[model samples]
Target: MADDTEANRERGIFIMIYLDYAAHTPVCDEVLKSFEEAARDFTGNPNSPHTPGVMAKKRLEEATENIAKILSAKKEEIIYTSGASESNNLAIKGIAKSYQRYGKHIITSFLEHASVTGPVAALKNEGYEVDFVNINKDGSVDLEHLKELLRDDTILVSIACVDSEIGAIQPIDKIYELVKTKPHCFFHVDATQAVGKIPVSFQNMDLMTLSGHKIYGITGIGVLLKKEQIMLEPLIHGGLSTTSFRSGTPALALCVSLESALAYTTGHLEEFYDKVREKNLLLRRALEKNKNIVINTPEDGSPFILNLSLKGVNTNALQAALDEKGICVATKSACCAVNTVSKPVYAMTKDKKLSLATLRISLSHMTTAEEIERFLDVFLEAIKG
Candidate 1:
């Protein structure tokens, strides 16, 4: 997922058909209110021992416990980081560095966001033997192939609960079953795209990462849930703050906002999901008729995201055309457009041209049927030429 601030603001769109919720979302009004109140009332460093600091620390812990409760994790397991990128790095590098003596092999899939793939690549450079797990044609992990990749020496297996590009939900529980049989292996999941949109279970995961902005919370804060027995080398080294794993002044307001956002998202998850499903089906039915386009999303993919590619058209051009007419969509992840090709699409379809022409039109509960209709009209018009 990416930032909404980058939603073609340069085009100065006053009216927008924002089909890019998978990239990022607007902050929830209630979550924003909670943040403002926290900022005003809790104005002390949580690390300080003063009265104000004590009060602030108390609220921060309260927020942490609230977040942990919602995720079915222990309060002590929550580690706040700058965002999901930092959390992914901390989990991947931290675990690899901490357990290198036990094993040097790691496994992941092409469906992971840049955060997971980047850290895994960094580990590869540092003499860790890394393997790419094969994914099914629908963009889900090929568990049979994962079993082949698993070995006594495989230390970490990191995959996302949902692929942000294709919205394919992975079989985390089944995968965890395979990974845990190896005593040295640790299972990690980047649930950034799955948490609030769907019911994400923390059952068999040793480490999990989630972003606040992806769930209508404040942007700079993210949560990483680590099991009690897992020891990770600290990514940030300094005086202890909330946890020894990552160090910084506790973000009182962001923490409050995160709690509020999760509460709201989960409280009405089924409502939001069912509504988004209708919009997804509407778009899918309309888009499927275009012979020049190929739909990449799976039959059982998350309704919040749809991936497709134009047969001969350059996706960036279509994206720009849509932007010019007040529609916001994504050619790739917010951070990955420069790559100019969709790696996930290639992995799913094995067609180089289609991968190069992919566009991701993501939906959200906030989306209206009118917006989808407007988008289809504009999108079809733009591609006609």
Candidate 2:
């Protein structure tokens, strides 16, 4: 542990046990290798007309095809972007802009990532009506409230497939059934946290967003999967690349890494999920042994995230203590940055103590049992102190 601490310190911040996979994952070695190889051989602009460019374009095409195969979607339906933020921006704003004439109202849940919320807020500023559905005490979106809000003027129904702060898995199938019954409304899912951690079928989903960095892939690349018949106005336009949806030379190397990572996760998902569940259960049981601590994550929530509240403990003090002991976790969505208050998801749960004193311990396939045990040791010591 000392040697690990030294190495981590040399790397910048020292956190021996990194349990914040929901925020972002370290790139897998295999994905890194593929990224390096692609960078070396496919450096040409994918949209250029030269031989090298043609080769790079082919690599991009292959990568898109591979990822589409994994998602069971058509290649043309996949649009590459810088990351999930861009994908969500394009999906929400593009749809809102394109379909504005048909309807000016859009419905979404309050627990969505800032990427989605920001766009919806911007749309509201521009005179579009945006209605947010309430979440249940367990942090799940209320589908009945959504159904009540649906109207002929509601052009889109957007929701996060998984609550990033609380780890509650939304019932997308049930939401889809409700939305599908409304012929005028299109369904979009921000599946950034759910993509690799949970099984997702795009069969009933019209639009889905995925982030590469969340699934051990290289950062700066993401995918927006759209149904074949769905159309949205282009977000960025200039070059002829990306079928005019997005313009500019595609990141061939990043695309390759993202595809490879997704394929690897899809193949080993069952084993990985089982291991993650075992580790999470171990940590949860150990943490619960302390009568003062409360488990906040739903029992049936995604296996990778554990949200906890330490009674009579200040979150900042606990966080500092954990950091000193070389444990890394977070208090809220990393997207919101450190030191920020809890998100709407926590607020909706109505457990004020848990909401404010919460800590999120997110896991990954690479997270080990030993790391989890070490975390509990440090956590208990911190709480006691």
Candidate 3:
């Protein structure tokens, strides 16, 4: 019976109409090609001193330089990591560790990804005080409340440039203006959901995190851009890799793929945005026509992510029904989806029903209008069932 089931599963090819770009994107073909070439040709350890090693080191430097150019940041500011989660942890913990003597108070928004919230929570357990800013119904941070929370002993103010759950783009520029005026406060942004999807500059940020997988690059690769003057303790110790901030055998292929992905986005941003916006509008219209649906994501947010709530339908059951029909979407952040409840979304919305019924549908440049229509058709049917 098991063998029969296995053979049946093998015979059925699941065509995933993925709508979860906010969680992670399928690696782009151009990025995969670049990565494959690097993996096959640049296998030498970057830390070695021999000729192959020298070449590998040069390749890594070139990749870093390319990514930095696209981000408008210095090459030295970009530190490679496994992904944005690690980058967020390193940024928060490293800063907390390095500057603990200066202050013990930290501030962050409740809507931040668990990657940020987890680190802040850990720091709080270790005697550091943390203040969590509340978000408005549209999922925007309350800037006045944040300002009130800021104090002389506040050492860090961390926030997400884009809320992964509701896709609301925070006022990072406004927050930056407010925080930069404080000489002692450092600003960190988890830009995993913002980079590549929208315009981003490092000018106002003390530190920022980016995930390769979120931008159609290979997984297990991310970037942390830190201001040159900012002090951060090393997360890992050993031979020099990423200015000794993170130490490991660098994934050269992943880095090369990330650089290629960035290049691709830089060249096609306008075209990509236009197409995604059109598809998003189409999807929004389709969902809006369904009186059972309530749009949760902000209307003005990133065109790539759409969050919705369906009345009288369980989100998990709806997701399962959609999966059975060969459509792919998510109930929440992939990292936290397995949990029975959405902790992050609840922190922002404070409505259990909104959090439980919420489904995130994200788009990529490759997503088509046909796919959106098919998904809506399937979704409407599923809700009826």
Task: List all candidate RMSDs to the true structure.
Answer: 3.5, 2.2, 3.0
Tens-place lDDT per residue, model 3, 221-265, is 999999998888877888766577888888889999999988887
Query: What range of 10 consecutive residues in model 3 has the weakest lDDT sum?
Result: 1-10
Alpha carbon lDDT at 94, candidate 1: 91
What number of backbone clashes does candidate 2 have, counting pairs of residues 3 or more apart or in separate chains? 0
- List candidate 2 stretches off by more than 4 Å: 2-15, 337-340
lDDT of 1 by residue, 1-385 (tens): 1134256465554566788888889998999999999999987888889999999999998999899999999999999998899999999999999999899999998888999999899889989999998877878888899999999989999999998898898988999999998989999999999999999889889999999999899899998999988999988898878988988888889999999999999999999999999999999999999999889999799999999998878778888878877789998888784546788888888888888988999998999999999889878888888
* Off by more than 4 A, model 1: 1-13
Each candidate: what lDDT?
Answer: 0.90, 0.85, 0.85
Q: What TM-score do all the candidates reach, one by one?
A: 0.96, 0.94, 0.94
What lDDT score goes with residue 384 in model 1? 86
For residue 147, give model 3's deviation from the true position in Å.
0.6
